[model samples]
Target: MDEGINSSTPAWLTEEFIEAILREDEKTQHLQVARADVQPAVAKGDNFGGLLHRVTAEIYYQNNGNNQEKSELRCIIVKSLPSDDWYREVLDQAGVFKREMRMYKVILPAMYKLLKEKLPGVTIPALTARTYTSSITNETLVLEDLRPLGYRMVDRRQQLDLEHCVVALRALAQFHALSVALNDRDPSLMDHFREGFYTPERRHILSPFLQPTLDTLASAVEKWPEYERFGDKIRQIAATSVDRIIDVVKPKNNSLCVLNHGDFWINNILFRYHPKNGKVLGAKFVDFQVSRYSSPALDLQYFIYTSAKEDVRDKSLRHLLQEYHASLTHTLQLLGCGKYAITFGELEQEMKERAFFGLITACTYLGAVLADPSEVVDLDSNFGEESRKNGGQSPMEKAYAGERFRKIFRKFLIHFENEGLL
Candidate 1:
């Protein structure tokens, strides 16, 4: 509470806005949010990951309408577009900023309402969000900060261990399950979500960044004996990556095209651990900037390839699939949906078929994942003018190269090849 609530507040987070929300409740009539302190929430490695800032508020009041005074603290996180014109344009074209606002304001709330009505006890974490879109190019997302609940991110610089993987998968399954039941209750419930994100506008913006990474990755692997066998296929996959992602976005064979957390990488997940033993107790997701309606397998593949190392993935892949399917089915049934038409086999088939989803994403992002926090390049800087000029390679592309990368990339590719994805 001692932190200064100064004039440094961002334009989007005004005192009137904060007071209106705080006093919206009757109990707050006896109190006032005197001031709000804004703090930087950016991690060292994520200087520009989501352009988020934290707002902490101090509330003051008199007890029993008397002279006795009291105070309390409240906090929320704000996500806004980067200050860069280029970054703002990219996010607007891709509808990334708007899509995330929709996710928090529309999709997540709707899904929660459906679950509450259909299944009594079954629930997931609740997200409290308010959005301010000042213009088409300027947007902000104020979300419930999970840190107050002792939730912390599992290290992204290293692969997740078994407990972390299991907790994340089970939690994701619960979320996916909510989508399943909601969709079954109303087949068109997710029609808006199905808009999909790989539009031509997005592709045009993303291609520059993607192409350079692929070329750099290809160049790095060409000399490595481990990837030499699959280098052409790898390069080909990289070159045509965007189109492949777009093609498979359309649902097939009665797949609900379940709501997918389009970016399910470690950076977007948080866990609350038991204080004494330090074991994971709860998990939740953040950053719906890329959420869309697509085959649930897209999320599954993305999560596995991005988070787990070789052994955990190799030995426990199917088991993880089973756990997810079980949670999904259990949730669907709880909503009184009949005859789970989507079976474990169907999910497995999709996983096998969409193996490249994870392969490409992991190959593209793993380097960034493993990078040293201090050495990590800012997102805007990483994809800045220099990269656009040099055919898409940035310091990020350089980070994506080297021995550690080759080892992890080789394992993922070899696994995909054995599974016939190559």
Candidate 2:
């Protein structure tokens, strides 16, 4: 029996199967296993995909006497759910393990295989191992870590030049086009794979977080008299927008619903530089825990709002949308789905309607939470606990956060006025 295999493996994962997988890797021999201290790592940021507890360690092959033939190997990541009680609750409530297993094991692999077979130049993460231990609360996925490929994570506030945006948009267009082509070629396969992934119910799961944040925003907006006229508009939209957003995305019969990197924000994307010119070579996406079947517009809206800075958001909006449409059209033609995929006009209409979804939600909800100084429970003693308590952001930080919120909000309202859609 493989050291990690047990009867408790989910039905989708079996002991015979796990042993076969471990056998394929002959380089490493298991030595000792230990748990990692995860608190320091957690302090880094709250946004690194899933919530992790302590990290688990698996010590493998080592070499000795002659240094020429020797190497030490170990794999470490925050302990997954199967090993931690805290994470188990999180996985249970979110159903993270089961849902992601389906995505990684079935959907993503199929997509990668198809893309590799058709367009070899396209880049995507290569799946490695998917192992589940019932005893531990979390599932362990050994994947090709892209960090080794010279990809680095970027902060949302970092500004991207036009060239970088264009490259990324082209990649996104190809990704969406691949899905459109797959659906057109075999509608049944697309339906079967995407059925459970895209539903209105997922929105409800997010409501607990959304509703409170909206209420908080509603309170904060009262202080800004300049925004008073728009207050009711924001409130009305915030209250019912979750369901409306979902309704807007519900597909209408083989409409180009693709595998979207559900959280297409800056952090989830990794970028690398070219060796000679030091220019951004390309970007690779990761953290697929939120991967779902939704209109490509969802990803577009998210990428624009979270990835682009204020100037880009304000000045380059139309240009970026046009760029995305062009990329989509080109990729569809390459994949032979041009006839079935959406036209530039249709994409524009959808973007106009749905572009505000992420912006509105983030501003009205996240804005309030981020602006509130009390949210930061701890900081260096130099910052002073009293100053850091309950919406403790510095005045400058709060102002910047507020400005971002208002900018997006004002744009949406002005757009509604111009389009006669409000």
Candidate 3:
């Protein structure tokens, strides 16, 4: 498929449409659009996890104000539904595209208003991208382009280090805390966000990816002498993963539930750094297509298992949890929901109760996370035409057969086996 902003670009992306949005954004009615350039934002290999087509539009407009003489350029990212019929149908059935639009339009704005009203002077860092506008009919989203603002996505193949992981955890904690506060104030705030990735209705969309990956993990583990004993356990989990994985989203304790960035991983987060010393400054999240209302543990474990380095996940996990809890408590205190804040012990209990989620992430997502650049196949190509023809193994399934994937899957299987979750 042509993944560029060329002749096939949407009809609504005309100069007149760009001019209207720009005029509203600048609050200048007289601004006139000279021209606009729209191009693909991410490179080929970087779009592995994305369900939407992404493009960046550099809008050149003449500002009618006194100080601005030349045309000022504004850059924004546009995300739209895939043009492929099969993929688009699956996303439509799952309702992820609409869920993301509502998240940016209604839910997140409410949370932002709550924060501003509750804490007038304190500046809480941003949790995600700033949405400019979105359309349910067009299946498009216009958002602030963070690239010009110095935020960049880390290489997916590289394991996230301690500093980046901490930043992500802190942001997630704030997100969870704020969602909890908003839900407490108005319970219906998340009524529309009821379905998650593992919802029964979504199985048709996910199983083609999930079942194959799990079976690949089972086949890969059976080859390892040390891990050979757990092959049956892995197969057992694969057999019932679709039905069992839903447990991750169900609220065992209703009081602790919050909104989850369901697809939280390296690809979905962007981080800003100091130019001089390369120190991490802040991070922002993106891609809420699979955002769900659930226990925060699912997001926490999904991120750590799919993104963090081995040492970080093995040794410093507790420290990371403490950091997340500290931020969560502080944010709750700021939002005047201190009484609802859970203790660290309670947070630990939450993780323990949802331990199966970590295993689910390992089987389904870890291969893509560790996939070599050469293994990056277009989602539609992999899951649509090629998938129907070649039922043997996908590039992603072959990624599971790699040694790195084997070692990581072994470790997770052992952990889950010890915990009796498998």
Candidate 4:
């Protein structure tokens, strides 16, 4: 369909109008009209009675007037941009949504093909079409709506059980296997495919944004003497290590590269259940805006640190690492990429280096993200206000976030000390 309607144009236009503008020869009887409507879905903020945005739609399909078939219609709960400026800023910071849509058009098709061939039982969304328009600030992806299929990510407050973790780990391993196999068979093609993923512009934007947060976080920590002991160390680490975190951890070299869902947090994954018994059947990965080529360890570390609870992390860190390594090894063997992929020891080393990357990022940003509504900055205000109000987050929340990172930092330090990997 022609998505060239002007930004000022009224959202509602007849199907004939759209069809004529697009100049499609399809019969009017077969054309479907999709309209956008806003509905309450999920709250975007943590405050009591905070405002949130979600996309809801009424879909109409043209069929014989006499025939009564339940209209194929659905409502999807999308995480909407808070404002037009926010939408524009995200596109400007990341590239335009069109660029991402094009990238997904290529990679997702390949991933779907590989999954269908190698793992027939696994279910994922079938991509129908994608469209980007001025009215839709980001981009609207039209795919088989998987929500009605009963898929959802586990809640953030809850930890996935060992069985669920195993399933997720194995699925991720298989995904990495396909990536490695593709890269091995046609190195140039894979390289070409990844060329569209990372642009220098994005790296430049991320570095500066992270640096300011690092500075603000440093200033904020000094207020608490108990935590102030680590202030200089944290600042030094943030200043000197951010580049290494981005560069070494996210190197574009072919040998170390795989397709990573850059935002690997739990919310982006959806789980479905068996219809007959209402038992969990499988999970499907979503949200490809940050999908790109990077060390697979980047995703592995992100998932573990962000999704696992403190107790789970303390008890299962080593075992979880081992399980990931073993699953990856087996999947690589199945895909015949084991010959070219890294060994478990090598993977462990990469994990150690990359694990710190996530810790630093979490310390610098997570508290601001997760603080209670009463403790957060005004969404409409400038960064100056944001920094001053909560100093980016509540003192308690920031301390908790810092403590979490301190634990991770000590773990890495001990690993390096004992193994002499430093």
Candidate 5:
């Protein structure tokens, strides 16, 4: 039985569409972008995490602003809606595509401009991108690729090291700090973006992903006698955590809130390292599909818990937390709101409470994240045709059920529970 599932490239990345995005910038007005070779930014057919292809564009433009010579620009990356109809619909209905477009087109520029004007000494790294459509039918976002400059994700399967943590934590601090500055400058500055924050209704998107991961985790933890009860408890929570995760993003009085890059794991980040010595220099954040107005704790907890290598997390969590807060304090000070900096004490309290974000990140994400090549599930089958038929234990469930991921899940559960988080 063949299901006529429609999955292909977005119709809007054509040369004509590319030209219009170029027209958005005053600096590029002198040039016309006719056509370019677009290649998958990660790998062919790999949408990375969010059903969006990370793509790089090779563009040649004729300089007409000065009637000068034409030039080829190689500094751009583009993201487009998945060709898969189901992925498109899910992302669209959940406001994922819209939020990311708004991030690139609206929030990012506003935050950058505010940073430059309000805190001259502050440095914030941003992606230079043009967004075409928030419409799920033809969503497109063009971004500046930083890889040519020697920045990329640390090996995804490898545990992130102290250096990676230091760079990521500090950058996250600055990024969140800027959000505070944006809010302080004008309480309304973030109003537009806040509308895109995750909501309970968006839980529909998680349904396809959750239970299978829970089953996988449950099976993995079965060997650990200590985690025996948690296997069932995790299954229970994983089902309900969709709504719970959204609920956690809501308002809390007295706690300072900022726009969160809701998905703060390693793959969503890029790092620039020193050429001569291989020391990590800085980091840049990408992917704001799930970004929203919420306690900064959401991003902080998600990053440290899910992305840190086990040893790094066990040994350096305290140091990294301090580093994160130090950067936050200084950035807030530069924003002239030192008094409003969430104290390290307050931050810890918040992180403890929001510990589930990391767990959710682990269960919902790490299966696909940590899967071996031979183990990779064809998401199209489970999420597409199969879900439409009768969805139970899926290939995704089986793909993630490997012993390695199970142990990883068990470790996360044990950690959270030890902290009184579960």
Candidate 6:
């Protein structure tokens, strides 16, 4: 452990705070901290798409007892709001930060408790990192650092293979199933989760960024020969893009709705592999900031469009969908929510009905997904006064203009056009 902490460490992350967090995480009140070291958990470009800043705290602690306590090291990840006021205010208005805090502090614990009581003896896969503590006032969350537990994030530049996709889908299915069961137990369980990235109410907050980005994308596409038609489609979509998103995300009557991981993609998912064979064993999700109570189809579409490999995205999509459906149904049955589970036909229909979500997500996020690590833009610099000074050509816009992003986006554009979504 470092004798001195990093200068950039948050004021709230004191030795006392670390002691309290360790107590909660270890479930042992006798743990007393000797010292702690705090440093950035991820590199600048690594978590560029994430809104919150992350730091890891290493605590060297001892058990308070007469039997000769020995110091041990424990690591935890702290997620906090960005220091930039402009970015903070935008996210504050969107209510993502508080919502995520609630997700960890309230929703997940209740869901897990319910499962433990109702399905005793059933083994549930760990669907997310454990939250040791959180503070709405502090705008911070202390979570179990999954890296030390062998959970690894798939590289942003690389897409998920079949094994990884299956693991992710299984975890997502269980997550959605548990959410549905909890909602059924108490219909208002997710009242606070009603609003997410695509709500009509948040259009004002999102349009300023969405419209211009689409304009840049459309302008780029216009220069390509056969791609000019997609540029026209992009222009039309950009004119009322928010409205289109709201339409797709709005709750419909008689649909299989579950809590949507509003930003489900490769970046938000982590997988643990089998020790000997290196096969994916399980998956965990992170960043609940944009989680919304919407159709499961939204998450499915978002995952397929943003994270799947080219072969899977283009050819093996249905196979992946089948895997997700099987997992969803199996989980639903296990949780006594079998009646709420939709058939493969119904799931397919729902995904097809909301196919526009795939296009909407692709237009906005696909560039970030395909961008090289070096090409990734810092989230704050892209949004703050820097972008205005760049004449709206922020580092993000330039990333979207990159040849790799354009070429990959072109594939989706063609697919969407063929599917009549464009």
Cα RMSDs, all models? 3.6, 8.0, 3.3, 6.7, 4.9, 2.6
* Per-candidate local distance difference test: 0.71, 0.53, 0.77, 0.53, 0.68, 0.79
- The count of backbone overlaps in candidate 5 is 4
Instruction: State each candidate's clash count.
Output: 0, 17, 0, 2, 4, 0
Cα misplacement distance, residue 112 of candidate 1 (Å): 2.2
Candidate 1, clashing residue pairs? none
1-422 in candidate 1: lDDT tens per residue? Answer: 22544344456566666655556533355666777877777565653435677878777775686632667887777677876567777767667776777777667777789878876786556532334322223366666677887887877767788888888888887787777766767766576666446665468765766766776777767778756767676777777888787666667766646778888878788888999999988787888877777788989888887787668887988888888888777767776764644788888888877777777777677777777754465666655666456655365655665556667777777777886766
Candidate 4 residue lDDT tens string, 1-422: 23433342334333343433222323334545464444333333321112222333444555565433454443333332333454346444554344445445665566557657766786654422222222323344333345666666575445465556656666676666777776665555455334232344466555655666666666665555455644565577666554555565555453467766665655556677778986766666655555566788788777775666556566776777677778778877766566766777877777776767566545543453344444443444433334445645433344334444454444533443354422
Model 6 reaches what TM-score against the true structure? 0.91
TM-score of each: 0.86, 0.70, 0.89, 0.71, 0.84, 0.91
- The residue ranges of model 4 lying beyond 4 angstroms of the native Cα positions read 1-37, 45-61, 64-69, 77-87, 96-99, 117-138, 159-161, 188-204, 223-225, 252-255, 273-280, 373-422
Model 3, 222: alpha-carbon shift in Å? 2.1
The residue pairs in collision within model 3 are none
The runs of at least 3 residues in candidate 1 whose Cα sits more than 4 Å from the true structure, single-residue gaps closed, are 1-21, 24-31, 47-49, 62-68, 121-138, 225-231, 385-395
Model 2 poorest ten-residue lDDT run = 32-41
Give the Å error, residue 89, model 1.
1.3
Candidate 2 regions with alpha-carbon error over 4 angstroms: 1-49, 52-68, 72-94, 119-138, 159-161, 184-207, 364-422
lDDT of 1: 0.71
After TM-score superposition, what is the CA distance of residue 57 in candidate 6 from its true location, in Å?
Answer: 5.4
Q: Model 2 residue 51 lDDT?
A: 37
The worst-scoring run of ten residues by lDDT in candidate 5 lies at 1-10
Clashes of 1: 0
Clashes of 4: 2
Model 3 clashing-pair count: 0
Report the Cα lDDT for residue 188, model 4. Answer: 57
Rank by lDDT, highest first. Answer: 6, 3, 1, 5, 2, 4
